[model samples]
Target: MTSRPTPRRAVLTAALAVAAAASPFASATPAFAGASGSGPGPAEGAVDHRAWATFPQWSAGRGAGTRVIGGTRPGLVIGDPIGTHEYRDPHTGTTAAWEYATWLSPVRTLPAPATEVVVSFNARTPAGTWLQTELRGTYTDRTRTPWYVMGRWTSGDAAGDIRRTSVDGQGDGKSSVSTDTLAVDNPASGLRLASYELRLTLYRRPGTRLTPTVWRLGAMASDIPDRFTVPASRPGEGAGHRLRVPRYSQEIHKGQYPEYDNGGEAWCSPTSSQMVIEYWGHRPSREDLAWVDPAYADPQVCHAARHTYDNQYKGCGNWPFNAAYAATYPDLQAVVTRLRSLNDAERLVRAGIPLITSQSFLASELEGAGYGTAGHLMCVVGFTESGDVVANDPASPSNAAVERVYRRRQFENIWLRTKRHNAQGEVRNGSGGICYLYFPLRPTTRQARALASVGVR
Candidate 1:
């Protein structure tokens, strides 16, 4: 789901109102300080910031007690995984600490002032065990803020599919499934050298013998330049500019499958995800999508919606959730990252991968598309000979009406401009220039080189 800023908020309100309202980050201030050696260099239109801390590189926590199981072993989780222990307090009859483990990442710096930062990884643990992923950053002043909880998820079938149930401190205890990863947003204004510490904590009941395991962890940050302008000349760019991508429309499925957020009308995210998933030649089996409407031709989209829905957020368009859901598929390397521009996106299209992009625009802001949306998700299938955007927009009335083109400049503004009104009516940038790339870990010969050139798996 592209982050349609306005209508989606309205959707959230309307849905919550019907249910009499469903339910729904960073610490402290440090003196500003400069980064060491200027940190990383930036790209022209956008900066791609990435820092990874796989288990092998992580050291057990100190000062506070830390726990580790088979450290960095294949098929083994190497983080804290202790069962709960209960004790009675003077005032309270009984008390318990479900949280029992902690793992920390080596401090690093974010290359840019990012609009979004997401931590992703794979893990396995028995049912009932809960895990919390949090991140804290050191400022230029050399002081660190307290940890910010990104998400809480329980372990699920590592090989079967990514089923992650995200829970809040106060949740219904319904487990969620993800594609082996979870993410949270850091809305800190202005970019700081935030590639600092990423903490992973594990929790479980006192009697539960099974412990949560974490196999891998990674963090990515994305930001775009204040403004981007297409170079005056590009000799061969946009020259064979059309990608062969299948189309799906969200409107067609509207109200069809109410179980998954009213089906199609609210399904642009999963519908768009399905198009890319199928483009990679992978589709869910009938049994996998059996929960969907039998009358629907593409039940896989419905399956995606069910899997990507965040119980706490109460929406299917959570950016990291969508990317994590795509990664659940076999042999796919997917991530919730941002692209610098159409130029960078075209690189993916040329590599045989289409991007699921988020944007918001007025109906009149973008031409060809019949309506405007506060936030929306669409596919960047290819470019026109003139360097325009050709998108597989699921917002259309039907699958046949899904494809459309827009001037490159106009589309860029809609896609790159991230400022929007919050629930309080103040404007702020949410996730900026966010896009997900779902591609095979290994590509065919024709696309192998292209994928390599763009740093895609």
Candidate 2:
């Protein structure tokens, strides 16, 4: 394990305390084996993919394999960190097996009629290899669907974030990639997301070596019904003061960082990440970001994307991955969670922690955020005196144009609901409320209570 700075250790201790109090699953052990709900179903994968155990009996491959090590962060360690050995049929020489390892999480029950499921991991792998994450679910009647390939992610230049594909039901790395995020959408078929499990597979090319490690894994299921609605809420506690968060615009890097997903136009996540990190007084050093162009302003934004990239997912906006990257710095703590409402956001800001949120809204729906996006990320720094939202929107044409105040009701509609376009151009079902909390240290007791009440741990 890498040694943490003294200040970081203090933060970790406090974070642990907070988690112990706030999270019911904090110290619970993951069952590791997937579960199948009642009903007649097909047999599941036989290989035991439990983390930290000896490798399972596969179609091929040899050696002792790896072990799952425990720490402030627990991860698997591959004994054979380098080298490529193809395990194939001796008779045909057709490559039957490539070097790989798998881990499956215990099954989780999803909200009924879930239209889409989002899975994320906090992982670090050597430069060449990629991590493939898959999700498979069982219906209430016990019918099992084939494994849905969520994404494949390699570190640095090869990361592919948010990959969706039509899977061939095979657990190998050859599944086709798609732009869709839905894993199981059978509203008419009578199949609802009952119980689902996750699998991680590692892949590497010949002549390359590096062990891959995963720190944390998470997934969430959303129904995203055809219509959208949000319940009424009481006033936020901190309805007046806005934090002085530094702004960075994704548009400024539009043409640059092409190695990433089309540069700044798709860089809302990284730009928002940069704003919060800078607000906490830690900037990546020149040597740290030496690979980026010296001519570009705020090169750290690009640096953030590179480090947060998932080779298989093919994008840089993985929620937990970005939060994990921020925690790399000293005295910083970050976690990805869904906030029930803006009152949850207000508590964090009141505690001096800025939030990075994800949403999809039309240009006309959100005032001051010029332009519509199928998806985007921005920082929620604070609230106006009358309970409006204060944000650093990186989608602006320039950095100076990034700060904006948005009306409370309108902002909530965009932030918390799922939506689709109707025939008359009306937006429906806008239900998405995902955010990451970035903080320098523990907040006051009252602030922590508020954060805890809103599920912000």
Candidate 3:
């Protein structure tokens, strides 16, 4: 029910490329391999998701003024500022000089030729700092494209921070980036992304000791053929199990915070995010909710809406932004990724992880939903003994009504299918199994195995 105006911006060509230090500074972090490959290789399957998340992977990558931090969670941090450059925050029309450093990931050749790529990140950006994610890729024909800015993000909404958002107009004719996704302009032209590299630039106000630590950086490359339906997989593992996840309904917040996407249904994305975030024992403190009206119950839901609202998209539903918001809490890590099947989702639930999933459907398509949505987010906490989806749906009239059970066949098709018809019978796009996964900096042994099983370690 939430829509936004096209984000218009003056061409922001902030190319203050400060070269990384050219010397090798040695360290003793146990660099691990890439999020051990899954889905399939370059010539098979419809999806290939790869990420550089461990110390060894970050170590394998070339970094300038960056250091590898090893602990329960191995990550990259800015050790030194390579140079200083002035950046103009496009949204605020403000400019400032900032010290920066960078880490470049090794090129990853996809297992399948992909028509689309979506990048997700996990990091904690302090008040005065932020990070930018970019990609440069080779086509199936070996021709290369320029580095496209996927997102320039900060967890803060303060005056000193740059407005966090995905660049609006990044493309090279053959492809274009829409929000968080990079799409091939003409998939029929027989061109696809074969390999790509990720560049992470860390920035902090000049001469400050503050730095950003990135725990995970990755992309989901997909080439799914357009189909209204997908074959259902046999249910296993997660049936008969459920996690005790808290619930909050977006409908109850109607007209409460219009400045943040007019609240109400527009708050579904962040409402669901907050549920999972709290399930893991984290929440906004009283000080964090101080700005909210004292009469408003569950003030943190309002807090989430404000912090996650993208100045560019003018909405709080930006996928990566929600994931980034979860990572803002200490010791939490989150990523926006695509799961191939319900079986895959079961793996995470088995490991005690609740997923925030995205989908678009008509009221008649998903039984018991009572209403339809062009786009919506809900927490998939578990599966019923009969294999139905047990979800903490935030579309209810109250928190007491938030927990719902959706049919397995109906939920599967709605979540996985990339195409669907509206109530009026017009064709519209679906979310294609997009999900937000959040866990601790150090997960349980079972959680670790479950995460690694889904290629997320």
The C-alpha local distance difference test score for the whole of candidate 3 amounts to: 0.79
Name the lDDT of candidate 1. 0.55
For candidate 1, the TM-score is: 0.70
Clashing pairs in 3: 31-55, 31-56, 32-56, 41-111, 42-111, 42-112
Runs of candidate 1 with Cα error greater than 4 angstroms are: 1-46, 51-80, 85-102, 112-116, 122-130, 154-191, 202-216, 223-238, 256-259, 420-431, 443-457
Worst 10 residues of 3 by lDDT: 16-25
Q: After superposition on all CA atoms, how large is the RMSD of candidate 1? A: 9.3
Model 2 lDDT vs. the true structure? 0.57
lDDT of each: 0.55, 0.57, 0.79
Expressed as tens digits, the lDDT of each residue in 1-457 for candidate 3 is 3322222211111110111111011111111112344343211126556778787888999999888999887888889999997998888899999899999999998755676788888888888999999999899889887899988888777778888877786788787787778877666455778889999999998878999989889987776544577678788899988899999998888889777877788889899999999998999998988899998888999999987888777789878889888987878988887776787788789889999998888888888999888888999999999888999999898999999999999999998876677777755667768789999988999888877766676
How far does residue 266 in candidate 1 sit from its true spot (Å)?
2.4
What is the per-residue lDDT of model 2 for residues 1-457, given as tens digits with 9 covering 90 to 100?
Answer: 0110111001112222223223222122221122222211111101111111112212122224444666455555454433344533222244522456566666766434343455655566665555667778676567776777665554454332222222232322211123224333323333445667877666554434556666555565543222254554555776896899999988877777555665666678778998999999998987888888888888899898777654334566666567767766655656665555687688778877788887766678787776776667889988988999989988887889888888888888677754444335643333256677776544578656655554333
How many Å off is the CA of 35 in candidate 3?
Answer: 13
Best-to-worst order by TM-score is: 3, 1, 2
| Full candidate order by lDDT, most accurate first | 3, 2, 1
Error of 2 at 188 (Å): 6.1
Per-residue error at 196 for model 3, in Å? 0.8
